[model samples]
Target: MERKKRHPQGSGPTFDQLSAFIAQLEAKGQNLDNPWLMTKILSKFTEDIQRQVLEEKVPSDDTRWNLRQQMHCLDMVLTQEEKIELQLPKRSEIKTLESSKKEYGKTKDIRNVKFCFYSDEKDHWSTHCPVFKDPKKNSQHLKNTNRCVGCGFRSHTLAECKSKGCQRCGKKHHTSTCFEAEASDFDRTKVKSDDARKKTASAGHNVVDGDEEDDPEAQESSTENSEENHTVLTAKHSATKRENQEGSNIFLLSGTLRTKHPHSDEFVQLTVLLDTGADRSFIEATLVHDLELPQQGSVLMKLCTFGNQKTTVKCMKTRLSIWDICGKQHDLNPYAYKDLTQGNVQGVLDIKDLMYINEKKIRLSSSAHGYIEPHQPRVIIGCDQLWQFIKFDEPQFTLPSGLLLIPTIIGYMVSGRKFQNGDIPELLDIHDTSLA
Candidate 1:
């Protein structure tokens, strides 16, 4: 037969009874074989005593409560110790702060604490504390009042002065001035210096001549060598001048365009001047319609002052053949005009669209001297396109004919004028019929 387990009764023992039981168990040397079993026994006995005390309404001693309090105190101490261990740094930051304070001569603690006190007293105080002086109030902050060496202004130093001017006129002047008084003074000084130098040189030369007279053959040979050298130098200078003149005659013309009309078989040839001064290119609407040009539709081009301006223009599909004086033809795309009147002439070419010059093209430079007149049949080509061709000799023009006579350095001229109207198609039809 198996033995039945005995169950313990409720409300069995008080704190005093439990203590006495533990004491008796220790005195008999009857130690618990298993620690878990002893713990379970102690728990059961405590629960039973608590239930009994609650039912009897009896007050117990504070030993059990004191033990629990001790346990809580021990748990709190352990937690505090763990937190302190975690906060401990491998290397202290306070040492770094102290080193910085020594280098900058400013304490971080003072800065932080001073701000706190200052903030509290700000409403009552009219000025900052004397100890809290601004770092920017040093002598370096105060600018020097010395005048500039060049311009005589009080805000700058002597090295920056630029006060050079004409001594007599008090006007701004350069070293290369053409004033009569300055020229006269310079010439007089130069003449006097030259006279002195010549006298000294002549005395030296007299001594040298005397020495050379003793050796007549050497003197004659040196004179002959100097003459030969002079002749060679003159010939070389003349050759260089001729080469420069030849190079000046070359010029280039680029960005020519041709377009065909949509309705007719005719085409219009055009070229852009590439001038920023002139606003837009000029083309007749009738001429565009007459030529069967391709239209890429309209685009919004920004005006100088106005915003979002729209213009109706066509894009020419085929490249134009630009012919030079040498009869060479270049292929170029055509750009339509926005306005015809602002151009001031019959047809205005655009400067922007013209880009890239071939090796064979002529070059012309921009100049103000070239004149444009309403009476003359002359076309006022803008400076932008002209600059690419020939460099101007002067800024202002003295003669109108000078512009027409100026020759291009290098470029081909168109052999003949492009066929306008319906001439080419009519001739083609005649040829076809004759062949049939």
Candidate 2:
């Protein structure tokens, strides 16, 4: 029996999650035959569990070298669909191993049987047959038309045949080369190791395999810079770290929009994050191009950078709607811009009017920063001309810990420390009797 290598242990919860997922798969009598599904499963495992499994099972050739070798060794056995599904390198990708193009190395057209072009029979090609180069047998071989397997030529190889190539396209290449095939994820980003990505995931994490950018996302725009598709703004804010950020005073409400590009019949669910500090919302140019969103007009907008430099950006006005956030479709007429901070952020809209803030909480005198948290916000709400309409619950008194708990419709709003990163804010317990 083959012994498996001992791997670094994973966290208990992560191990449990992996075990449950595997058990479910096993209950269905499934084998890990599909590489894509294996990769997809690998993505769900926590960062540590993935490292363990990859280190133990795929240590030798995780860089895809083995895949290339398998593709070539099983080239003859692979079906048309299999060839595409596997993303096997094209005849062109592994050209180094093939015989020089100038020299037609023993190329096979008819599968399974290797025929000798010189002797005009099976088992070997003209490369090394005993009677391959004989001048006398060559004439006899050509005369026997009954022994032709392809092109009705006696003892001639397909490479030397005068027959026209694939009928589908006028080109000499194979018929399959003319049409486009389903694309593989390999065509875009190459997945990286966990430790390798952790170094860069300080601000946020990629929901999918680390390669967040797609091929279409790299296209050039009319502007100098390129667009980011579904990129969540990763700009970090300064905040002191706390032991338990889950208890910080913060409320995260999310909504989904079912929309279809005007030109496309396919409707997709897009999630948007709501933030108050952002002056305007933005969307990726890919959504605009794919959905064929029309530009109503353009305006000059000033943007403040982390470095304190101000830059003027040209934004286009477009309308987007999310139907069921508060039981009604909220429509936003926002301006679209390129080079957004993050991906998933569709657009920043002026939504201060939709919110119902407690006036008493807003009037409470507080001078402390909030907690730091980690989360992805897709939409930011900016308070502009309608700032006066905002209201907050006023706290008449403070707690022993200097935290003020203000009541709101959803939950109590606590004010004390600065809020950053999705930290749960401290809430005032109504039993404290400070307000009474």
Candidate 3:
């Protein structure tokens, strides 16, 4: 007896059966509108036929078989329209990759493949293989054999490795250039230890010994000696120290000459000081007459104070020869006053009136001989005029060393009269209440 074949339930058509049927149709080159094949296939698969009708249009025998084969391989059951929706390549069609390679090798047309040239015009050229261009496309490729995978140079690839040049020095070697290498490894701990030792040594040396009253006589003598030493040290180190006092008083002496009124030819120079404390600079009447300086006719000026007391006096413009300690000279136009009673001086110099005045830091001290009386030659230099030439250190109140001392000729207003009596009435009144 012959064995009977069994059909699996719900089992769709197998891919091999569909593929074979499609292959035969393709070989015969059937057209898409064949109704005979469509009816035969649809009747065999009723459910699939309905699904195909709803989803897609009917296809030729070749397309239908091709889609059925793919669907069966994917474990899918398709309707008649789905089978018809499948499209198959013509028998005369060529493979894309193979055609691309052939066109690239024959014409070197970059559009035929994925490669592009790195030129200004951005010309695209194809490669025989995706990995390598054909030798016929460019002579450079033939000469170099192949391109470098690492750097894209035709001479060598990474697999046929060659020496890589140093990027820093442009040398055909690794980064071993003398100028590019690290100088030395830094040892922060060693640096810190050295600094600590120096600080400790300085602190130890600065420690003072003994109390202030340990030796009364000895201390007195030491104090005197220290004072002398200080003077000597200051004088010695003064040359190296820069003048930084912004408001230091500056004094200049003008050469003297014979006056017509005095009738005696006594060479005298006007002494002028830049007084930042006072609003203006002043000169003694004696010096002004002796110097025979140019004088502009007098004008009335009012002098006042915070107390609102005012005094009117005549001011005259005068040109005086001024000389600095640095040996520089200037012709200063300063105001002179008619009333000497207002101030002990002949004129008060106001720095703001000066045309081109240069200021400098000067050091003044009381003379040990006491030849000059106190308040006799007292001069006040204001801060506004002085600030332009120097900078000050508050703690020292002295100028730093090495700053240039420039000579400037400035025009200034000299107060015609002194401040009114009530300007500072407190100075005039002395109270006996303290004694009582």
Candidate 4:
């Protein structure tokens, strides 16, 4: 006789228990990503709890809190931002609080509640601000402070000081920062001292000085070279910063994605961003609120984000069926990364399970993407898998070096736009650094 397979059994927590559990997790800075755990917690929510969450408990009886709506309410409560703006107390609430304080002969200073930049009102929206018009009166007045470093006054910001020609030798610059000017003054002083010494020696006896005075021309050339080198260094530093900024910017492929659990008969469709370089696939927590998949084994892994920032990512793995928009399912064992994203791109497809098709789209398993939508794919395909779908075709060129340099990084030098008529799709190498 065949034996029945054992399954992970769990009952949903009560509404009160679930709420408290969520609060504890949030306090510890934990993120919920396990679809099974999420299902268990929300399943036990009573109609009263759901109504309370949806504000349906209010005196208005017309409020209908559907399953999706209730799930969204729970999701909003679970998520938080690094910098949460505090909601100011309403005028009525402030008045009530002040009245209560007055009963005890106390007063409350609530001046800090005002946050509008365009208004002087204690409480106001930007649209109601009176100073928004005629901004000259409301401006920060930064131009008035643009005093000249040379003059120490507002007449001219870039021009030299007319009052004190040059502080160093009445020539053209400030004494502190003028190295060349200071050197010239030192040379002049040395020449004057030598002339005085020679005149004094001639008065006493006949004396001839054989040594020649130090050359100012050589020193001046050296100073000019130093200045030129400093300028070159500054230009190089600016260039390096520009290159680093360009290299660090993100370029992710986006498209619509459809996914479902292994045991689930129904597929859930969502928009996903593919990380063309992530080791494992991931799904957003919010998208799995309705999914009832059993919890798989938990794993702890080190994840490195942009700029090589290392962090620990707690994940739960389960076999997921990735379906094409046409309903074709692709077998993929993907992990649900706890609170990885905060948007509609619910799942990140792995590059290992994907292949680029034609010249315009990417294929997940065998289903390819075409056209565009509001929520496109943001899936980051991994490098190892990306290599398989990428191949370069070297165009014919007669050169002297006898070397074929496949232009990967700088494809812009060859082409202006992509997919023009008569353009062969196979020759288009998007996986190269040009697009990658």
Candidate 5:
């Protein structure tokens, strides 16, 4: 047998293979003590194991002693290796791998097929529809075609459609066609009406008194009413907007990293959000359970959220091994959370969708943008451990639209906010949290 045919050091030919080879040589009437026969059998043993056998003290008279003792030594080494492998940390679990396969199968089904809401066609998805490129034209087409503004279907109208409404207005209309300014104005008007009703109820006697004109309180009330009327009109009809715009978009940094399986050579892919503002790193508890990770004891953590709300919870820590863009491995121990944010970092992206990135020849960690799954990240690499995973030597790319592409150990992360088709929803208020 060729030398290359021998298995590697950690996993060599099985004991059965060695036994069969020896039996074959014995049947040929070859001398079991022949040095050539012994050498051939030894070749099948891994290089490391062979070396160990050579160090054995065999009486010079017993040449076949090493060959006969090989099986017992090999078995001992294999068992020890198995124990060590079990002690090592693994990235992916068998259950996760199986579920991923099922998810992939589901993604291939007819329901997951791409379709354009604008043209009601399968040639493209709604995000890439030609009609959707222009808000006015898309809305006009939906109206002209008698399609539901909420879900782009002809079977129902906007009011009757059961699909989720615009995230901006919470109205029965698509986000692409939502007018946030209108919603804000309406809300302000309702609040003003409620205030006026309350004032009328509390000061009913003052309004009926003609003698109140001489009273300073009555005069002040009249002046306030006039100013309020002027303010309402200015808000409704003024072309100029307020100092802080009602709607603003915010994008958090996120990317995908490769993780190695502890027992096997296979690597697992994980999507993670890089939060420099966060004090502690976190991983989803469900994922930790699924991966069957080893916990290094528990910590009593004090979690603080928006409005200074604080809660005490028990947190478990587990080791993680992730590969960077250059295939450098990083080991980390992050606390576990029952859940993370529901928001996703970016929408489905493809190379064709981002021609600018291609024009600039920007290198990315992920090989294919189309294959980057659009799912909420389960891992958050907080500031406490963020520097260890960042590549300070690499250059950062800033797009014309204010979107920033940052180079980190894991990948080139796409971050910073961008207005989607001039549709800016309400500004998101992110509260910094403290973890102990």
Candidate 6:
């Protein structure tokens, strides 16, 4: 009966455990090294591992491997596959939090909401304010105060704002402050607008139904982008090229991550960028090859660049164990790509901003990132596993210069735009990605 047992499903027994079991059977006077015994051992593997091993025809080959050789191959494949299986995120683990409608209803009356931005009273609406009555002054006020022209908040910009757009021009700005047309013609133009214009207005007004504040991590990048003063990079596959542009403040959260060496106990460290925008994590193929990381499987993925260009590529999947800020190890299974990004735009912060952060005793993951030469990140941790690394209890701080410092399991991640006296800085914040 014991000889008929099989490896359990899910994360099955380790290679050492199976080897010890076989050794125990041999100690009991069983001739387990024979072909028949080898076949039985192969059958004992979990369903998935068995199927993988059989795919290469090890058992059916004309010149079959001996029992020891068969065991070695099976063990090798089993180790790689099981590691990936264990690291893969479960469906339940990634589910978004339930809506906060009930919570909102309970606290709606006493929410202490601020309806106006310009007034010190905060009780009256901005429309009632004397200064907001002037369209030109209202527009200038929004820009100078770094407020969203649509929602009139400092949290997000007009381009990124999710609130309702202007009712007059259908643009992402307040209707009262719209300079596109006079107030007398507003009603006539809005009603007679083309279908495309109406569609744009409808799309701009559509907001996510549920409470967005429930996921603060998702809001971090948006807040950083809105506060920063930088230009947008719209070129296709621009990350592969070298960026020698001066005055560009390309800020992406990057730090050194560690994984255990496959052949030894020592840890291997590699620089990785944390991106909340990407749905799935990615690793550079060259780094995987250099590290001798065993490939578990392959995935066919269509990668869409910043300029809306799409390319389908086959990505190899592998498991990695990375250590966080508190020295806790996390297992991640990431898809491997030929390349991710090569541009490293330094000079992110000026002297005054640095001094302010230092005075506040703020922690940063990679303060010297600006001083370093161009480097391609070996890994990019996307939204799929990004929340696992974020530290929610620790409050995030925004510098007077508009850069946000976010706390993570790895360390503090610096984000946002920096301004210099030269020409406008063109930055690449690769956010539009979908995994099909």
Cα shift from native, residue 206, model 2 (Å): 30
Top of the candidates by TM-score: 6
How far off is model 1, as Cα RMSD? 34.4
lDDT (0 to 1) per candidate: 0.31, 0.39, 0.33, 0.37, 0.60, 0.61
Per-residue lDDT of model 2, residues 1-436, tens digit only? 1101111234132323444566687689876446785556455434644555455554465555332232232222223334454587766656654644323224433434676555557766543366535433443454454423223344456566554643444544222222311233464234435454565456232111223333331333224233332222212122223423333332222233445556565655553333333434555555566667777665544444344543445556666654432234455655565544332221121123112123223321111122212333333323221132122552333433433444322123333433334655544211100000
Write the candidate numbers in order of decreasing TM-score.
6, 5, 2, 4, 3, 1
Q: TM-score per candidate, in order?
A: 0.21, 0.26, 0.23, 0.25, 0.39, 0.41
Q: Better model by TM-score, 2 or 5?
A: 5
Worst 10 residues of 2 by lDDT: 427-436
Cα lDDT tens digits, model 3, 200-297, are: 45633221111122334434444433321110000000110111222212212111211223356442322233433233333455556655656654
**Per-candidate RMSD, Å:** 34.4, 27.2, 35.5, 32.5, 33.1, 28.3
Ranking by lDDT: 6, 5, 2, 4, 3, 1
- lDDT string for model 1 (49-151, tens) is 3243333323544434333332233334334444665698634676765766552213332222322122235333212434323322211222232323223
Candidate 4 lDDT over 1-436, as tens digits, reads 1101111124344334555667788689775645565445554544444344546324434335333444556544433211131356667888887776652113543323543344435675322355544323223221344534333234454353354534555644333223444355678889888887676476332222222334444344444333211100000001124323332111123344456644665554554443442434555443344465445554444443223443444445555455544455555444555444432221222222122222313323212342222232323333323232222562432112121111221110011122233644332112211110
Q: In candidate 4, where is summed lDDT lowest over 10 consecutive residues?
A: 228-237
Query: Counting only residues 3 or more apart in sequence or on different chains, how many pairs clash (N, Cα, C under 3 Å) in candidate 4?
Result: 18
lDDT winner between candidates 4 and 6:
6
- Candidate 1 Cα misplacement greater than 4 A, ranges: 1-285, 296-298, 304-319, 342-436
* Candidate 3 runs further than 4 Å off: 1-274, 306-308, 338-373, 378-436
Clashes of each: 51, 41, 43, 18, 0, 0
Better of 4 and 6 by TM-score: 6
